[model samples]
Target: MTKIIMRLQFSKTCAFSIVAFLFLFSVKAQDKPEIKIGGALRFNYNLSSWKDGQKKRGGDFGYDMFRVNAKGAYKGIQLNAEYRYYSEGFGGGMLKQGWLGYNFNERDQIQVGLTQVPFGIQQYNSHNWFFNLTYYVGLEDDHDMGIKYMHTSNRFEYQLAFFKNAEELGFGNNSEVSPNRYSYDVAGRNKEINQFNGKFVYKFGKKSASRLGVSLQYGGLYNLDTEEVGNHSAVAAHYELNKGKWNVKAQFITAAHNPENADSEDRAVVTMAAYGAPYQVAADFNMYSLGISRNIPVKLGPVSNLQFYNDFAYMEKKAAGFTDSYMNVTGVLVSAGNVYTYFDYAAGYNHSWLGGNFVDDFAKGNPNAVWEARFNINIGYYF
Candidate 1:
């Protein structure tokens, strides 16, 4: 009996030692440096119409897009990559984004790759869907192959970028001038642009806060003979006011120089307003609007809240002209531009998930889906 008991005790001790060794190994593994990867997928349908002679209408529905992004970080070095696939009838088939980054302390970093241009408030507010309306006239798309430097501290953040002129990539190419034979414009030939942008935000009072920002960009295009023919410049300003549940936002943007015809120039200005609290009708995400918004809560499967909004605006396009000769003949040509007035009404629903929630319902639904046949609608989703 004593011999058997001694063997049992020895086996039990060995089992405990093995289990403890595995637990410690796992803890050490968890402490090691590693890289993480994740991304999202989206699909959409869009329908849009414009007045050429009469009201022309067109629409498309398909697998709008699918995108995957991966990021790896170790110590102060970071790398990111993104790939996108779009269905038929879209501009391009495959799009890609890649970047390498380094951090200098905690408040500053430099990244080089295809990235977003840091401009208007709408450009960086990843959570706000209404920002789509504040379009800057001359800035490139959200994604461009470029290098950017970012700095952020307690109360301020700023970014600057240098980008490859997208026109050279056969992306934003101007085919009108070279319809029969291929000819490159000065801007398309050089294929480079310099951009500067910054923002200053301050928190004050008990419940109120404010922010202001400015941005500028300049680029030049050269022809085969290295002659500068097309030049472009843009500037913008943004301001925001918030107190309690009421908020106000405004922006102004101007651009000069034409991408299509190197010799031509185009310019525009935009302003917007928003008020109320989240989910509240008065606070429903609305733009350049004057109206009321209210939020109605409901118990449902996916969507838990609804917002109703109505807005009206009268807008006029600005006259175009060159900085050197604001009153030149070209400036007079700007007067021929068209002005537009719009009246808009919208109702939106927001959804919350009980468990894992990653997808944005608004972005998944058909942007042109009509609530009522009486009026047309253009909707967007954000994530």
Candidate 2:
């Protein structure tokens, strides 16, 4: 027990040292436009029915993640960065976002480096620990080593980008046949190295500010079993309404893959973002999500407001033999400045990804426990 505590402390200390150094360096820059430093500590409590058996719940406490962000503009040249320290799931505390920007004016600019892949909805609208399904699918916070040109006006925004690393995943690894965690590359397959993405968004209404967006992605997929390269494409349409205390978000996405030699369990997939099923290649699938949130006019000690939300997603494969799945999350949050707390209940039907609990439900052809419930509570303090 002592050893575990020591190790955890060591890791956090190292991460803090790096963040402190970066902040100090930024402070030295006389032209620094804005310099801010912050991170978060989170605690999670969860209930898993199958893992702990029926009607039983178990959970553990541990580190979630810490992040530091810095952004500044000196003489029209923008410098921005956001680094993270977490359980090396995707990347090992690497630069979650690091970029250098050149602005020709306010409406146009070019950003180069590891940056966001503008696809689907810009962000997600869920209180789950892992983000929405779009993230598991490589659409949410999926950043890549690439460059992009962006244009923005009062009501229109557009972006064009090329990423060489596909999903910018697979950094810490060994040689083994396993599920590809962050990248689209199939286990024991050639990696995806080249891709292009573009997005356009239009904003309307000043009071109830609404946005509609369309995105397209074209990428190359490498086959492990056949040693060949294939093509993959995806198109998405998204719409959101953010006004007053009500927020609504919705998206429709479809993808197609043409792989040389791949089976249903192995193929090029962007990410496990929201597919609760096995991976398949040479297939067509559609995924959609709708979310709504509202803020209640109530405040208490250390709790500024009360917020409630619900999000739902449905995913289906076009192939005849493929399985379909749906997931739903309904939760409430309490927000007090930089501190937030979440209480949520999530349920899945026919979910089959990542040892999901709904595998037996498909075999029995019934919702059964697949539609059972799990409760989660997360308390976080952001600095």
lDDT of 1 at 214: 70
lDDT of 1 by residue, 1-383 (tens): 78569747855764565445334433322234556665444443333222232224454434544556677765545678766555444333444557767666579877766666666554432112121222211232344555677887656777876654332244434321111111111222233343344444443445436666776767543333333334556566666555543445455555444333223322121111111101101101112312223345555554454444332221112232211100000000000012111112222222101011112211122223332211222222222
- RMSD values for the candidates in order, in angstroms, are 21.0, 10.5
Residue 147 of candidate 1: its Cα lDDT? 64
What candidate 1 gets wrong by more than 4 Å, as runs, is 1-33, 45-61, 94-96, 122-141, 167-192, 195-208, 223-226, 241-248, 258-299, 304-383
Score candidate 2 by TM-score against the native.
0.76
Give every collision pair in model 2.
136-272, 136-273, 137-273, 189-224, 276-352, 276-353
Residue 156, candidate 1: C-alpha displacement in angstroms? 2.1
TM-score for each of the candidates: 0.53, 0.76
Tell me how many residue pairs clash in candidate 1. Answer: 7
Overall lDDT per candidate, in order of appearance: 0.38, 0.64
Considering every candidate listed, which one attains the maximal TM-score? 2
Model 2 lDDT per residue over 61-109, tens place: 4566566778777644567887766565533365567887776567987
